[model samples]
Target: MRTPHVVVVMGVAGTGKTTIGPLLAGRLGVPYAEGDDFHPQANIDKMAAGIPLGDEDRRPWLDAIGAWAHGRAGLGGVVSSSALKRAYRDRLRAAAPGVVFVHLTGDRELIEDRMAQRQGHFMPTALLDSQFATLQPLEADERGVAVDVSGSPEQIAARAAAALDGLDATAPDAIAPDTTAQAGPSPL
Candidate 1:
């Protein structure tokens, strides 16, 4: 039997991580985890007040998500996280060594527009800039793929599924090439 990998659907706040995560999880027949649920109330309050969380503020949240990811390792699960920095991703990898990322990429205007349309979300549109500023694209060595957010959630999830399908998830150092271009138009 093939080993199943835990997928982390990652990107900036408004790039649709929440929407696509469950879709991808459904496609893969795995459970889904909402990363924001891992955040403490304090962190939500901070972001709600337009404050960007510092590394110290994020560590606990990341660890919480990591712990969940660790628990789901090999069992196959999908989780969502902004995972905007290399260090944050590294922290996740430390806890769940085989977790693969599905980065949702899109233009700022598009993301901002989507953020405005969304309701009852604690993350304010004001924090979008900070999210983009903090984002670090996955490196060549990273075992993941970047999918463009230009299409519908179903389309985006389909693209991610296709990209992930091509990856050798069992390989310790499987490198998922940047498939953003193939997924759709450049979101850069």
Candidate 2:
């Protein structure tokens, strides 16, 4: 049997992290965690009011998610987070050293459209530019795959799963250096 590694479904808001995380977890037979649930009311309020959260505001939230990821170590699980900045991902790695990331990448226009169309999400479409500005694509040294978000949720999840399957799960750093290039083009 293959060893199970926890997967962090990461990307900018509206890239379908919430949608894809659960499906990927089902495929992997692991529990799914909504990263936004870790946020304090203040953080939510800030975003809802069109304010982007600063690093100081995000530290506690990231720590909470990291704690959850740390607890799920070896048992396998899926969790969603923007994890846009390298520093945030580094913080997560500090807590759960073996966690692998699945970055859902998409075109700015598509992501903005999705955000605009979605209802009741605390993250406003107005904040999307800031999100794109903050995102740092997964680096070569990172243990992760970058899956494009140009398909249905099921298709994207499948792609993420297939990319993850290519990783050597037992290795400490299961890096996929060129997976981003392999994800292909945006349809719209």
Candidate 3:
């Protein structure tokens, strides 16, 4: 078998990172690490106040997430992170040299609607516009795959897993293995 890769499920909030990350991890048979859990308290507080996080506010959190992902790479574990900007993703790559990113794509209206309907989350819809504005779409050299988020959670997870595993993107026969049921908390 090919070696399992550390996959970063990246996108703006409400693009299903939290939901899909765990399922992907379950299929890959690796630990799920939520990138949000690594955010600094101040960054979380800033988002809670409806302020978009600037690069200054994000640096430490990115470093932490990158370091964590690096550790996972060393262990052959799977990890999920937002990694919205190209620069941020670059930094993460520098930290975890061989990580693969799965960029989740969706319409702004759709993402905003999902964010509005989500519960128990500190990220406010007020920051959605800023996030959309700041998002740097995956560049050609990023070694990433972009999956549209208009499908069911299972579909999204399955696509990400297949891409990382080097299977056909739409291989219906290659169903994702269930990892969440056996793994602990998920991170994206």
Off-target runs (Cα >4 Å) in candidate 2 are 169-188
Scanning candidate 1 in windows of ten residues, the lowest lDDT window is: 179-188
Give the CA lDDT, 0 to 100, for residue 167 in model 1: 70
- Candidate 2 vs candidate 3: the lDDT winner is 2
Output the worst ten-in-a-row residue range by lDDT, candidate 2.
179-188
Overall local distance difference test of candidate 3: 0.76
For each candidate in the order shown, give its overall lDDT on alpha carbons: 0.86, 0.86, 0.76
Enumerate residue pairs that collide in model 3: 26-179, 26-180, 33-187, 34-187, 34-188
Model 2 error, position 73 (Å):
0.5
**2 against 3, candidate with superior TM-score:** 2
Model 3, stretches more than 4 Å misplaced?
167-188
Q: Superposing every Cα of model 3 onto the true structure, what RMSD results?
A: 8.2
